[model samples]
Target: MTGNTHIVGGIAASLAYAQFTNHDPIIMLAAGVVGALLPDICHTGSKIGRKLPLLAKLVNKLFGHRTFTHSLLFLVMMAAILNAFMPFEAVTAGILVGMVSHYLLDMATKNGIKLLFPIKLTVRLPITTKTGSKVETIVFSALTLLSFYFGYEAFRFYL
Candidate 1:
């Protein structure tokens, strides 16, 4: 998926996590957004990638696209890593939800991610569409709308 789609998915995931856990909505939202972008650090062209090009290039050289970073193993590892520092259940939940959202969004694209990695199985939805295609645009728009609605509700309830 494109950056916009990833961003929308991140925001939506964070909002949902906040609503579900009754944690600090702002912190969850921020963590979720960051977590969503974390996996794409391997791609030199991604927003986060550009910020740390050397690290991104190193990751790409070692793992390549849709390999280690896009796998369930990676998600689990990340959750564990975050859990150590965050300790808080709500923060860990937000991170996991954000990562899952990123994986799911990539699955919806034509070139599905290597979810299982070493297993070499690419899990994708039945509906096949290119990233940033018309279908993706529509999906992104819907996600954006949902994100906005959730944000408004969160603000009304919390602030």
Candidate 2:
């Protein structure tokens, strides 16, 4: 999925998470956006990768794309890291939602991610679509609409 789609997914995930918790919606959304793009740091051509070339290149060299960062282990490690530093449970949950949303979206692709990494267990949806294709466009659009709807719902107090 493109960065924009990931962003939409992140926003939707954050909003959904907030519905069950009292965390500040804006902060959760920000963290969610970060989490959404965090997986792509392993790809040198990704949105975050372009901003941090050295780190991206090193990650690409060490783990390759859709392998390590996309793994469940990596997600667990991220949760641990956030738990250690972040005081808010809701914040941590928001971040995890974003990361999980990214993985779910990636699962819709043909190559799919190695969810278990070294274990090489690939998990994907039965049907998949090519990245940046018409199908992806449809997915993006739908996710975008969902994001907007959820965003409004979450921030209705402020609006």
Candidate 3:
């Protein structure tokens, strides 16, 4: 999946979560975006990678793309690190949800991801598509619509 699709997936997941949780939407939205992009740090060509080239390169060299960074172990490590800096439990939940969303989106791609790393096993959805194919564009559009729907459902309580 492309960065934009992952972003929309993040937003959609975050907003849906906001509907049930009491966390601030703005904060959750921001965290969601960050978390969604964080897994792609191993890819130097990724949106987040472009912004932090040195870190991306280092990670890529250390673990290669889609290996450790996209694994459950990485998620646990991220949760621990995020908890140290972000005292708010909601923020951590939002970010982790977004990261999960990222993994799910990538599973739809042909390349798949190492969701259980260190085991060298690649996981993917039964139906997969090319990264930027028409199917991905459709998925992106659907996620966008879901984002809007979830946003409206979540924020309606405030209005």
Candidate 4:
């Protein structure tokens, strides 16, 4: 999936989580966007990668795209790191949700991801689409609608 799709998925997932947990939606949304872009740091051509070229190159060289950075091991490490350094539970929760959303969106792509990492197993849904394809645009649109719904639900108290 493209970065924009991942972003929409992150927003949708984060808003849903905020609504369910009654956390601060604003913080969750911000963290979600950050987490959504984290995995693609392994791809130098990615949005995040472009911003941090040196780090992106190192990560890309060390693990390659859709390998360690997209794996469960990376998620676990992130969870641990966030737990230790992050003072806000909402931020941690949002980031994790966004990261999960990232991989879930990627799972819909033709290339898929190495969800299990060291095991070298590729994981994806039965139905997959090429990145940036018409189907992906449809998925992006659907996710955008979902984000709007979740956002409305999460912020209804303020409405």
Candidate 5:
């Protein structure tokens, strides 16, 4: 999926969190957006990767794309790291949820992610598509609509 699609997925996750939690929506939304793009930082060609070229190149050379960062191990390690350093439970939840959403979105593609790394198990959805294909374009459009609706619902009062 494209970064734009991942971003919409993040928005959807954040909006869902906002619907249930009493945590600050603004913070959650920001974390969601950032987290969605974080996993792809392994690929230098990726959106966040382009911004942080050195880190992205290092990661790409060290582990290659979609290996460590896209794994469940990474998620657990991230949660632990955030728990130790961030200390903001709600924002942590938002970031994790956003990253999970990114993984699931990637699962919908032909190049499925190794959700469990070092085990060589590539988890994938039965229904899949080529990345950046027509299917992704449609999914992106639909997710965009969902984001707009959720955004309006979540922020309408302030608007």
Candidate 6:
């Protein structure tokens, strides 16, 4: 998935979380951004990956793509750890929303993510859409529109 998609997913997920939990919109947005980029830390080409290339390389070497990082187990463990050390509601909400966005965005690609990694069961949607293709272009455009709408809504709420 592209960075724009991640940002859109983050915004949408954050907005949804805010609506559900009634937490501060800023906090939920922050969490959503973190969640959306967290999973891609394992991929060298991801946004966060460029910031921490060595760590990304290490993760890639150790686990490879769509294996450990993309698994439900990884998300659960992350949530558990965050819940233990951080504020339960905010952290858990952020992580879950982010992971969900990541999973959904990846699913939009031609080579879908290994959602149930380590189980060797690949779950891909029937629709085939390559990243940066026409489908992706349309999807990203829609996401951008949604993000802008959500951002406007959030601003209105806060202001």
Full-model lDDT for every candidate: 0.84, 0.89, 0.92, 0.93, 0.88, 0.78
The candidate maximizing lDDT is 4
Best by TM-score: 4
The TM-scores of all predictions, comma-separated, are 0.93, 0.95, 0.96, 0.98, 0.94, 0.90
Worst 10 residues of 6 by lDDT: 16-25
Worst 10 residues of 3 by lDDT: 150-159
Candidate order by decreasing TM-score: 4, 3, 2, 5, 1, 6
How many backbone overlaps does candidate 3 show?
Answer: 0
Candidate 2: which stretches are off by over 4 Å? none
Candidate 1: lDDT of 132? 73
RMSD of every prediction: 1.4, 1.1, 1.0, 0.7, 1.2, 1.7
lDDT of 4 by residue, 1-159 (tens): 888998998999999888888679999999999999999999999989999999999999999999998999999999999999999999999999999999998998888899999888899989999999999999999989999998898888888
Write out the backbone clash pairs for model 4.
Answer: none
lDDT of 5: 0.88
Better by lDDT, candidate 3 or 2: 3
Which residue pairs collide, candidate 3?
none
Worst 10 residues of 5 by lDDT: 16-25
Q: Is candidate 4 or candidate 5 better by lDDT?
A: 4
Pitting candidate 4 against candidate 6, the one with the higher lDDT is: 4
lDDT of 3 by residue, 76-106 (tens): 9999998999898878988998999999999
lDDT of 6 by residue, 76-148 (tens): 8888888888865776687678778887887767777777777887666788687778887887788778767
CA error at residue 97 for candidate 3, angstroms: 0.9
Per candidate, the number of residue pairs that clash is 0, 0, 0, 0, 0, 0
Worst 10 residues of 2 by lDDT: 88-97
User: Could you tell me how far off, in angstroms, the CA of residue 11 lies in candidate 3 after the best superposition?
Assistant: 0.4
RMSD of 4: 0.7
What are the per-residue Cα lDDT tens digits for candidate 1 across 1-159?
888788889989899767766788787788788778888998999978999999999999999987788899999898778878876776777777888898888888878888998788888878878987898899899989989988887889555
Model 4 residue runs over 4 Å out of place are: none
